[model samples]
Target: MTATDDAAAPPLDVLIAGGGYVGLSLALALKRGAPSLDVAVVDPAPAGAAARDGRASAIASAAREMLTALGVWSTLEPLAQPVEDMIVTDSRTRDPVRPVFLTFAREEGSAAPFAHMVPNGALVAALSDAADRAGVTRIAGSGVTDFETGTAFQRITLADGTTRRARLLVAADGAKSRLRALAGIQTVGWGYGQSGIVVTVKHERPHHGRAEEHFLPAGPFAILPLPDNRSSLVWTESTETADRLVAADPFTFAIELERRFGHHLGAITAEGTPRAYPLGLMIARRFVAPRFALCGDSAHAIHPVAGQGLNLGFKDAAALAESVVEAARLGSDPGSADALSRYERWRRFDTVQMGMVTDGLNRLFSNDSPALRIVRDVGLGLVDRLPGLKRRFIGAAADADPSAPRLLRGEAI
Candidate 1:
């Protein structure tokens, strides 16, 4: 689709505010699921900018399947690194050595690995390309400035002062979504007083697709494998400590990193400038408002302890797409209260459940209480010993929820 001035553009069936992964995927999914529907995405970032974000995500098996069903996974598969095993340990930041308390290997009978570490850029690029091919319009370098919902359609005002209309409006904006706030959606959450320091490190030896999580007093530190003998570090610490570490000189920063990183992989060097983000759990009290719906971080943002945040957003996109498409197929108004309610009902409980799980895990593990530590370690050991239980845990991490939407199950809407 050729770029046209927003003023002259026709009304859209769905107008999504945000061009991140969830927004792009939702647009593509909708177009693919119901070709007759008109969809467009608006974001303040220039076109292709999101594809340059310097981060990676763990795509659970279910999310991978959804991407494959959307015909974008093949494009990303080449750059994706499958996770073959995962090890968990609990220790202090200054511990001489952290002992693994739990380990999960590739489960038998599973066609795909539990998850794949995929660069966010590659995934976004693939989805963007697919959306373009699917004839979805993208309004770049601008965002929804305001909107007025109506019975039949919602009038939208763009940041560039262009007005357009849509049957439904979606907020796939980030956790601090301006659109969501403007829609008067209240959120419930709290800051963990922790921050996640992110960086890519190149190790002398290959990781062989192993991921590790060390539960330190401050939070969990994760080393997720990337392609080319590189691994992404997600080091969690007190907010102040994280800020100080990231701002420290190269030598000091490297020293601190080494203290937590250990020598399991031999010598390591930082691959890029380190960045830190404050940790928090924010869930919108409601996922839908009038003709508007929330997807991705706009609806819920959880701790990265389980590496399921991105996958949760994908689930939201899949479920919302399926709901809207199925409604249209039934000759129902896609933006009707009944249709939006279904999407809300389908996702709210699952999202809440994940939020509670991650929150509880973070609270249980991010501490130095001796009694709590012993209890958690024992729990981890038990889970590791129980093969059936381990498989179930792995399956859950892979987004194998039985009530998953058809799109998430790799089924056509």
Candidate 2:
């Protein structure tokens, strides 16, 4: 259904708040899996805003498979840079030598790399375009202002005074989800007092598809490879320090960036304005309530130390869509308690496990304690030396779990 026809349209089966990659993908997945369902997405950002985003993300293999199954991966593959290998180092900012304690390399003749780095703009554009082609109604430039869940539907009010009812209202509206709060769903979380500075950097030399994560006193400084002679940086620091650095003059900022970025890339230059996002660990106390559910950042927000934030969101999208689509196929209400419970059950353990992992990693690595450093470094070294264990770790991150959603396993729902 097009936005033009929305006025006369029937109540939707699913109304997703937020049109980021997660929301868009979920809408597409639902429509593709069950075209009879009415799906729509609403976001405050104007249409085409995603095309201008300068940030990038690491798409795990499982996410790539889901995109492929949805027929969106081919369009995105050209803009993606496969991660050939990764090296992890632990050291202080000024340390002359940052020793690589752990390394993960793609095996020869491997079917695919574990992950690929793609720009945020490209990803969202592809997902949005595919969603449009899939007949998913997209209402941009408006957000859900208020919502009330009735016994049969969720009455959602838009900022523009538009009212729409949906059997299921999925809040993918991000970490500070207004819909989640409106649903009386509390979140268990705390600010880490750290902020991640994201910036794209151009380098004279190619990265050869290698990603790096350096554990510094402030936090993990990640250099994720992108296509061309560029890389995306996620530099974490104390909230106050991050704010100051982002406001620093270009020259001063570049100097400080170099202190952590190092000279390996050679003649690096910032490509866009640096932005800092406060980091935290947040998980909604309940992922569902009546005719309401939460996905993506609305459900759980984790540290980017492991670059799993977006992948986790994709996981939620796939899982939730699978549950809803299956219910619809069975002639049951897609938003029924059974369907919501299945989604929550399928996602809860994974969400909490990842949240704890990221939180623990941030605490263990984002400090200057001498004793802790030794222990973590030794642990990393031991894991690196064990090929079987390293492969298992890579498989886990790549979403190789056999019980994952059909879409994540490169199959249709």
Candidate 3:
């Protein structure tokens, strides 16, 4: 209930190294699922820092279910925008007409949309509030500087010169996770030579809940609908070009944006400062070692071609929470080899599968070869024409495997 400061604080059942969406969600789920477990989150950011995140993410249906189960969705629902339909197109930057090759629409009988676009700040705030309410300790302005495992627990040294112990040390840190590296977990990945320019735009007309992905020669440029008349752009380009565009004057940047964003939205204006993040594909060689485990981007970082990165992280939290809570309920070591092994087995394949799918998609479409373009366009057209196949694709995007955690199924753990 308070910021942890005592160096001799009793060992926590779970100590998360990052206080982002994944870490906070996992902590909230564990505390709510099993109140007796001692959980604490140590983040390097100062207190109340999550409210400043200027990005938004697509929360898939399964992730929404998990959030709702954790009692955080209600606080975020009013600010979220449900994606009603999506269209994919392949074309060059100056193409007058970008023909839609694939389309996915929300089914009539579905109770919820396939996904919703939520502001990163709002999601984090909601999760943090829920975490606090559930009695999870919040340690801000600090991070795990080093850690070592004993037979029963791990001793963690903090950047603030505090020492704490935990049965499980979860690395929900980002792609360049120091905890992951400190744990001796090697990653297999390479840079994409591209970067995604992320910014929010205010348009003259409403998007009507439609999302668009334009497959340009460099990469996929996504326009995701946000609440009101705003849309979030994940515009991809060569790393060099991306950096230049972000650094350009507003007038010049707007000119380039209008080239990619057509008259369909009438007129558009960038709402805030644009930032570019380099694209890459990274997956830890292993998800667990001794008392440590990886979660979220620490375990896998994929290209944003499919917009499944956040959902994958949410799934990781759900599966890990399920495994740990079940182990705790049985009076077994939640961080025992058996428990960690089960969590790894449940998530590693799914993480690898998503990584490869996004990687292949980026390779197949992020190019200018005429033959490859024709082949990919024809493939997209063929898939679009098959109603049953399209339905399955949509279902797969919204639903999870039958073996998913109870929280992901909108059930109590």
Q: Which consecutive 10 residues in model 2 have the weakest lDDT in total?
A: 1-10
If scored against the real structure, what TM-score would every candidate get?
0.98, 0.98, 0.98
TM-score for candidate 3: 0.98
Model 1 lDDT on a 0 to 1 scale: 0.92
RMSD of 1: 1.1
Which residue ranges in model 1 land beyond 4 Å of their true spot?
A: 3-10
Report the C-alpha lDDT of model 1 over 148-243, residue by residue, as the tens digit.
988888999988887988999999989989989999999999999999999999999999999999998888999999999999989899999999
- Of the candidates numbered 1 and 2, which has the greater lDDT value? 2
Worst 10 residues of 1 by lDDT: 1-10
| TM-score of candidate 1 on Cα atoms, chains taken together | 0.98
Candidate 2: what lDDT? 0.92
Please report the candidate that would top lDDT against the real structure.
3
| C-alpha lDDT of residue 290 in model 1 | 89
Looking at model 2, residue 332 earns an lDDT score of 92
Per-residue lDDT value at 125 in model 1: 94
| Deviation from native of the Cα of residue 90 in model 1, angstroms | 0.8
Which residue pairs of candidate 1 clash?
Answer: none
lDDT of 2 at 370: 100
Q: Once model 2 is optimally superposed onto the true structure by TM-score, how far is the C-alpha of residue 36 displaced, in angstroms? A: 0.7
